[model samples]
Target chain A: MATISIEHASKSFGATEVLKDISLDVKDGEFLVLLGASGCGKSTLLNIIAGLEPIAEGTIRLDGEVVNDVHPKNRDIAMVFQSYALYPNMTVERNIAFGLEMRRISKAERKATVREVASMLQIEHLLARKPAQLSGGQRQRVAMGRALVRRPKIFLFDEPLSNLDAKLRGEMRTEIKKLHQSLKATMVYVTHDQIEAMTLADRIAIMKDGVIQQIGTPQEIYSKPANMYVAGFVGAPPMNFVEVDLVKQEDQFGVILPAVLKGEPKNYFLPLPDSKQLETRENTKIILGLRPEMITHNAFTQSTNPEIECDVDLLEPTGADTLCLIRLAGHPAKARVSPLFACDPGESMTFSVDMGRVCLFDGETEELIRL
Target chain B: MANPKTLPGANGKRYLFGRLFIWTLLLAAAVLYLGPIYVVLSTSLKDLAEIRAGALLDLPHELNFTAWREAWSSACIGVRCEGLRPYFLNSVIMSVPSVAISTLIGALSGYALSLFRFRGANIIFALMLFGCFIPFQIVILPMAQTLGYLGIANSITGLIVVHTIYGISFTTLFFRNYYVSVPQELVRAATMDGAGFFRIFWHIMLPLSVPIIVVSVIWQFTQVWNEFLFGASFTSGGSQPVTVALNNLINSTTSVKQYNVDMAAALIAAAPTLVVYIIAGRFFVRGLTAGAVKG
Candidate 1:
């Protein structure tokens, strides 16, 4: 019900800036995730939005009314912490009713609210149980129940599911998505987990250092990362950056892999589509971005591709799939292959670079090129 | 380390031997510590003449309640011979309130420091921590003058306040360190759930910090109860704590040495804390062990 705005916001610790000239908006009923690694100030920004931390310079507005100086309790926003921070002493029912009690709501209404929230979260049977009595997932539910009872205008989650085991984390992630869909509450979630960002966010704000690298839908960030940082950070087994020189091959500009593959120690040429119009540029140093999945277990050519025959240096089995690390064009690169592929060290595997999906980045600037 | 379950009867043998050794050492330590207390109790039931013979470890050949009656009613330390019970009562009134108030305030303050980030909070915590390390005697003169200014000098309330003030540092430190271990999320959850400062402190923080509070109470009680200098300096005979009365009764400058009566008064002064420790011994040990392990 509330749209949160951070207008020209900045935060600092002493002289070191944590968030610099940052501005973001959480539209009414939007699920916006501030996604970044630790120390990237995503949590700081979330805390700023929650009125938990003061900014060095910024005005935050909720629903167009400035809330820069509002105390957190009066801001009508509830937060679910990563730690599940359920009051250890209080039973689940009391924990849920705490907000209502704080507002001096009538006991009858508070009880009803607690019951409603508990059942909604599937924690009703746990009403009389203390936090210690509950499992991690149950504690998580209590934390959510504690927040949901208030019917706050905005919901802030600071990596709420980061504490759960993998299976539980996935379940809760789905539950959160479902909860968001049903309630349509304006939520600002901060997380380092890209999976959470991808699954839960309406828009993902990917940040680096103190600056945002990109802000867009999950598809946009994954498909069209603005920089090398985003390209690498948003993917697991990450995006491979092969050092290359852009050269002109005949009539078209081509990217030159700087080194050889296997016993043939020479460059392989791959031409670029020239929206860049620089496909014919000679010896242009750049990096080619290829996601591990894009370079697959299948044959190198369903279409004529930028193919490289490389030595599979290492293979990691993650039960679901195998991650093959290969030395291609003299640089270490990783590829996600199907578990059916029996990959081993010291063997050559032909990796198909999906030229259509490949990203070109300026070598020195690390900025993605349109080509 | 051999697997415990696979060790056959080794566990039972070990347990029995360990108990025997531990009990033996415990008995030795008990005798060593309570040796003086035993002498005091036994000799306090003897006449002055028997005490003069100083057969220190002997059972009193002749038993007498004369000393107990005299110590409670007629052992003159000053112009009044109405023994140390008045001072004993004064000490109880002082120590009990002092410990309770100081521990409660310290718990709340420590909870605040641990849970919240406010301007100058760290600096305030550092100052409070430093407050605990300074010798209590150093603050006695200024504290007395301040109490006098507030018109409570030489009063029990004055002593209680002073003791509570002095006790704040360790109590705060104890509570703060313990509260720090409590997950910050719980406090945040409580706050987000609309519980304000005092509500969070009482309902959320304090209830979860029981072991630390027990630890704090036991520590503060022992400290405040036995505080001789504060008791002696702050009040004269009528308002003095039992330590002062015990000192006056045992070490009277102008009176003949009455060992039996003196011992009886010492025993009386020591009784409350001894009784308290015995009653709450399990909690005290639990609190202390938990505090040490965590800290």
Candidate 2:
């Protein structure tokens, strides 16, 4: 296992900087995923960590040894590219054994290792076939097997499943997770697929415009995104932001939320949690972040939790949960309700907001105001 | 069902006639191209008296290897009459080393230009491509001077050096264009596998280079074999290649033009390239088309 520490790394191509002041430390055996959209420097960062690309600034350490000047082969790392990057001319057996052969391993030992890796990947039946003959899923497995057979100090994966179909992507994703679990090798995966990031990463580093926005556990990123970008980027049905005016209700502080009742828009006081940020921001505008699941189709009776009756502008049923779009404070927001909840478009319904899970951000800076 | 053949408005008949006519034209064209070769073969097999008396297309009354033997051993080339045999060997010696050395270095250089990202790499490749456009006539004077300075002027080694230098740009172009389609990930994968530059080229790049190699080999072979300018300009006498020898054999003033002997020598000079094309012709086309289409 290896611990990768990237300190203040920056990379510039010509005049444009692709990675700016990036620092990340991956613990031993932890599966860290660099997640971002295209041109966000996620792939560039992964290439830097793999030593495929050189860094213009800062140093990279693999297991406490500075490896910035080391050749990729000497870094003791193997990477699975998004394209699978299987040596096309070599058969599955030779492809797996090539690394061993290069290391001057004995012929018999290379064969045995290849056989073991082939069987582990369940590609033994395909050992004689070339890469062109394999299906997309099989190629992905072979790519993984190539990385696995080496058993390097670290494994780097650059969107290894992005080329597969949806069904195969899911299967290969689980296989990768299982492989990581069994081997417990330090893996740094890069992908823009948030679901892949969410399900596979021990810690997800959300990046944007060559900068790391936040690096934390998946749950931490989901529940407490550092800013508006992370909050909107991580979830499938992204977090909804509503412009609200903070007001004081005697000793209590809350926002005046617009709700629809009896086919008419009306104002309701949604009490904010008791916090210094809220008190300081009273009488000023702030952005409120709410997840789809945090608001559900439920009737509030005794609880003092904030609830609103709004018209369902649109309804989307996704087998397990039906997402109902409603307007809240002049912006469209998604509310996740059970599929059995009979909500129709243009009909009014009550959605209970979990006030404890709500996030408040400074109006101008867009950074979360933690209290 | 209708009687399809007779029930038609004669369109099927017209279609058959059209196809037949096209085939007839293709056959006529094929014969037109092969007609000269047939004459050369027939003439080379006949006695000089018969060749002079009979029409070019007439069949020889007696097929013989007399001219072939004379051309291979004792036909006159200039005053020596040592025939084209020594010059044939000279051409073989020159072409083989030229093709091998140029192709090897070209493949390595092409792999570097295609896969590696070093500073000035593209500038170097651009310079080499500029070599492809430098007409031989434009540099022959400088080349002769250089060869004389190196003490290889008028020598077989000088001819080999000239052909190799001239062949590199084409060979490099062939291999580079063909290898550009190869993914850089393969190199990265090899590098990660602890395979260094030469190791990667040997283990990975060379294995995948067969088609392009055949293309390069055939190209260099044909070019160096048929090359009269450099062979004639760089060397003379016994060191001259078979093409230069063939010209001298046909142009000798000491004897009457021995058409049969000259024809035999000409065919012998062209034999190796003919055999190469007939053997690896398909791969040549494949390489060309592969280079044409982008991945």
Candidate 3:
């Protein structure tokens, strides 16, 4: 296993900059997931690591040796493409044996390796058939088997499970996880699915516009997001944001929430713990970032006072949990509640918002509040 | 591809009627296309008088080998009145090398253009496409002079070179478009597996491309086999292609036109391409549908 270090890598296709000043260090034996939207340079970054794409600037080092000048084949890396680009003319067995044959391995040994990987991926019965005769998931297994036969130092997977159906994708995801665990090989997987990123990665790198927004473990990114973008992108059903003014009413500091008090919504106040920063920053706006699960149907006994007194506007039942939309402080918010407390769409219900689990962000800068 | 139960009309009678109508129409078309060839073959086996009467649609009185005799030897091409055997050999020698060399160059150029992304690859590809689609008459004058300057004028080798040069662009265009239809990931995967350019092409790309190769061979053979303008312009008597000999045999003002001999010579001249079509006819259609039809 070798660590791959991308130092200030950048790529541009004519006038369009695809990747910019992107640097990442993938540890040895680490499953690093580059997570982003379709055009967010994740695949381009993976291609650079695989030596398939040339970067405009900076060097890539593998195992402390600069490998920017190395050719893809010489770099000793294996890759699985989303299309599962199996050789249509060759049988599945030959497809798996191709890399080994290219490396000039012995025929008997190649056969053994092919059988091992075929059984591992449960594609043994498909060995005699060409790719055209196989189904989508079977082709994907052959593609993975082709890569696995190489036993290269590093592995790159470019949306390996994207082509399969939902059930097959889940099955392949588990298989890939098991394969990585058994092999303990350095792998860099590129994907747009946050769920895949959360499950498969040792360290998830959430990217946007060619820059990395956050890089940490799944739990770390979920619990403490670096900014509004990271907080909004990682979670399903998303986090809720509401504009509120930090006000000091007497000896304590509180968030001045907008609510329907007099005619239209008024800036009603909610008391918070006394803080040096929040007490003096009156009239200054701060956004509250709270996940749907944080503001639940359970009682809010952890905070000194509840700031969000709101009515449920909509109910979205998702099997085990029901997602309820609430109008709190004149802004729409979402909360996750157990099916036990699930109410009808128009029911008048007030949820005790848990203030202790809320995140504060500077409204103008879109950055997290230090306090 | 259709199940009988799901067939149109859902009745055996209608299906049989449909099949009969299609067969009748196909038979009529076959008769229309092969009618002249039958007439030519008949006259080639007829005597001079029956041919002169132009009663070609009628059956010959009896089989005769006189036209084949005159067409092969002792017929006036100029003052000599010799046969077309030399001209037939000339055509074969010229067309075979031209087809082989041109197809090879085209397949290689097409492979490179389709797979590799060098700096000027696109520009070269566009120019080659432009070259293929232009009228040959527009460039023949300069091309002939260039061959003359190289001192292969009035020679069969000169004619072969000219045909090869003119055929390159079209051949390359065919193979390039065919290669484009091939999954590019195959090439990428081969590259990742440590196969070099030629290795990948020979081992992966070309093996999977027999259909296109058959198509290229058929198209280039037909094109070179029937080429008249280049053959006429490139060489004079004693060095002319079979088409040139046929022209000379029919163009004499005082000499009587021998229709029977002319048909035999023309059919003989077209025999190679016809035989090739018989061998690879299905593959040609398969290649077009496979390469051009969308997913």
Q: lDDT for model 2, on a 0 to 1 scale? A: 0.89
CAPRI verdict (incorrect, acceptable, medium, high) for model 2: medium
lDDT score of residue B125 within candidate 2: 87
Return the TM-score for each candidate structure.
Answer: 0.89, 0.94, 0.89
lDDT values for all models: 0.83, 0.89, 0.83
| lDDT for position A142 in model 1 | 88
Off by over 4 Å in 3: A259-281, A299-309, A329-331, B1-38, B63-66, B69-82, B148-151, B236-239, B252-256, B292-295
Q: Can you list the residue pairs that collide in candidate 2?
A: none
TM-score of chain B, candidates 1 onward in order: 0.85, 0.92, 0.86
Point out where model 2 deviates above 4 Å. A259-263, A299-302, B1-32, B291-295
lDDT of 3 by residue, A1-371 (tens): 68999889989888888888988898999999999889998988988888778778999999989988898999889999988888877889998998888889999999999999899888999999988888898899899999998888899999999989999999899989998899999999999988999989999999988888889999988877878988898889888988887776776677876644223454556666545667556778888787998777645345443644455668888999999877656677788988788667766454556666677788877877656
Q: What are the per-residue Cα lDDT tens digits for candidate 2 across A251-359?
A: 9888888866666888988887788767667799899899998888775333666778888989999989899988887778899998877477888888888888888
In model 1, what are the clashing residue pairs, if there are any? A85-B185, A246-A284, A253-A279, A253-A280, A274-A277
Q: Candidate 1, after superposition: displacement of residue B130 in Å? A: 4.3
Best by TM-score: 2
Worst lDDT 10-window in candidate 3 chain B: B286-295
| Stretch of 10 with least lDDT, candidate 1 chain A | A273-282
Model 1 C-alpha lDDT per residue in residues A270-358, reported as the tens digit of each score: 76675654634457677889898877765535766666666677788888878888766677778887777746777777666677888
TM-score of 2: 0.94
Candidate 1's DockQ is: 0.47
